[model samples]
Target: MMSITYRLPQVRNLVTAFPGPKSAELATRRKAAIAAGVASSLPVYAADADGGVILDVDGNSLVDLGSGIAVTTVGASNPGVVAAVQEAVTHFTHTCFMIAPYEGYVAVAEKLIEHTPGDHAKKVALFNSGAEAVENAVKIARIATKRQAIVVFDHAYHGRTNLTMAMTAKVMPYKQGFGPFAGEVYRVPMSYPYRDPEGLTGAEAAARALLLVEKQVGAENVAAVVIEPILGEGGFVVPAEGFLPALSAWCTANGAVFIADEIQSGFARTGAWFACDHEGVVPDLMTVAKGLAGGMPLSGVVGRAELMDASHASGLGGTYGGNPVACAASVAAFEAVEELRLLERARHIEGLIRQELGDLVGAGVVGELRGRGAMMALEFVKPGTSEPNPDAAKAVAGACLAEGVLILTCGTFGNIVRLLPPLVIGDDLLTDALGVLKKEILAAG
Candidate 1:
């Protein structure tokens, strides 16, 4: 596999303290201009980024493990994506697919159809963000099924849109004060092996969730059952072995659409084209974004043609959905993934991370090491107990940031530190970053 050529040096070098004078000055300007509601995890201001490193204005090169929330699977500055975007802009910026439908839009749709799970006749509707894709998927599911209730899992995070906010589980940041949200969304238990009762099997967990749906919202009233194959923001939780298959089976038997929100786990981030592929559980409607466009804002809902076509002609669309430049980037991202063999690269990253951090489980600092491929995370907990330790997670993340390594934290309890490095990241750079992570995690104890 060939790696993308990046001009920026792929080494972590801190020439000045993090958020140095330049970044501090920018922060002041940002506070004045940007909304207070918007927050950034790191204080540094990135001037340039390529491969595995982000260069701050202060001349510090930080090793990136977050991948901008898993959007840059092919690296932030991939040559193919950059060239495609540049060439596309020269031809035309935006004609709005809703106005003068462009070939790039159709091409991206075609790519989505081919890559997304299932061989069934599929159609795709593009959108500007993952939230839009998810919202639209729910809309499509409701229209197709003529049902009123949507089922979601506990600790699930669909998005922040009104309807998605109703679908999401967390309250503080994503959903708090965001109401009144759309109604008819029901929550059920997810098969979180790390937290589930001892000796609970995947099938048993599915039965429990199904029983709740049956008792609360009848199967006849359910529009769709949406879940993340490998839950994102809710802690990179990889459901138990038979959980996904069981859910999919239940959805099939109940006439509810099984929608896999692969926004954070798609595009080779989880060592597969999609996480659903790991279990051979094809979703009726799959919402995709994040890594779809190599950092360009683009998202889509790809699924059964019958369901996608159920909506009225103008029922689905956005003025900026499937923008020409973004479509070009998406196409190039697909090519980059193919040429770089990012699926294999993701698996390699998983092996490396597991090998480096697996010992934490025995040390008792890590309650569990979950997730797949590059989308891995460490759930920090009190030694010899499952009690969450958000402080430990924060300390480890902060230490890594101070040492010029960028990491991200998630989970309902905020006790998990997620690692989402770009697939193009070099082995040496990844090793160095992991070393920093190990040292900090150990020190946190």
Candidate 2:
């Protein structure tokens, strides 16, 4: 069992209604100071968080099912991460790894090599966020393959940067009004088992996508084939079995780097070191973030040695690519996962969530219960039909929040309520949160 050392109480307590006076006042102030485009799902203002509970300014402790969007797998205030960050800060903050190399950066790279999929000689490049890691991954692939075209899957979300926005599938929020995206970024069909045509096997799905790739953009011109092993923003959509392996094989044969964007699914979130490990699919390049540093902003691209080294000297780096504090936190985060055996915890959480929500499917309150390990989701749909019921999703999330549980919703159609509870959450707290989720989901019906 993971040791819980944070001061914040683990229990969910609703001392006042959700978003009480203090939080409502803060929301008003935030509206005045913050940009209109930026949005928050819940109105509650977090004062402190630990383990599975986020203490709001109004003295309400909300069960944190979202885990800061899956960035806090080891918990929001893991003791190891806190100690490491503090210690690293006392020594020095930033020397900019590019200007003067540091041991923390190298150490993080080494750890990533050991943890990410594949046993082959691999190299790593650190970055500040998932978007930066993805951008750098594409850059590396393009330079290494000497090609310009990059292939992305339908409903894939790479990031918010210019190039990544171009690669992303959604339009209304991510890409709308951001015109003239990066060139030569092609999109192909994804193996979304729930949404794909009936009876399409994983190999068949790969063939369909490959046929499109061959017909439209010659495989020779493709630099990278980027995909989320288990789609994150795309509704936690786990593709059909063998889909990843087929894609990997195709990329190897076609000279296109298979980039697994395991930003949300990495770091033992999917009951494994990485989701790609589930299918024995070793990606040529893997971009990771989110759970890397126990809520610290750090991302990296670990890949085969040749592809990483193909870049010219000083071609890949940023001033804060590998900050010492973030690196230290990342090292501690990895240790916490290992020490706590979070992979098994994630699987345990998955089993609990599936068992708790299983009845909703038969009741017509859920369309699908999908995803792996701690990264599970409930796709709300119109009762007795496959059509998306985004309203039901919204209702369920609102009901959960009102009752002191924080859940997040995501999907191409916005009908998925993804559950990403901290792996260190106590069994009692997890069960209680799931109970709240179940009540709200059924009530929505």
Off by over 4 Å in 1: none
Instruction: Return the TM-score for each candidate structure.
Output: 0.99, 0.99
State the weakest 10-residue window (summed lDDT) of model 2: 1-10
Q: What is the C-alpha lDDT profile of model 2 across 231-292, one tens digit per residue?
A: 99989999999899998999999899999999998999999999999999999999999999
Clashes of each: 0, 0
Model 1's TM-score against the true structure: 0.99
**lDDT at residue 403 of model 2 (Cα atoms):** 88
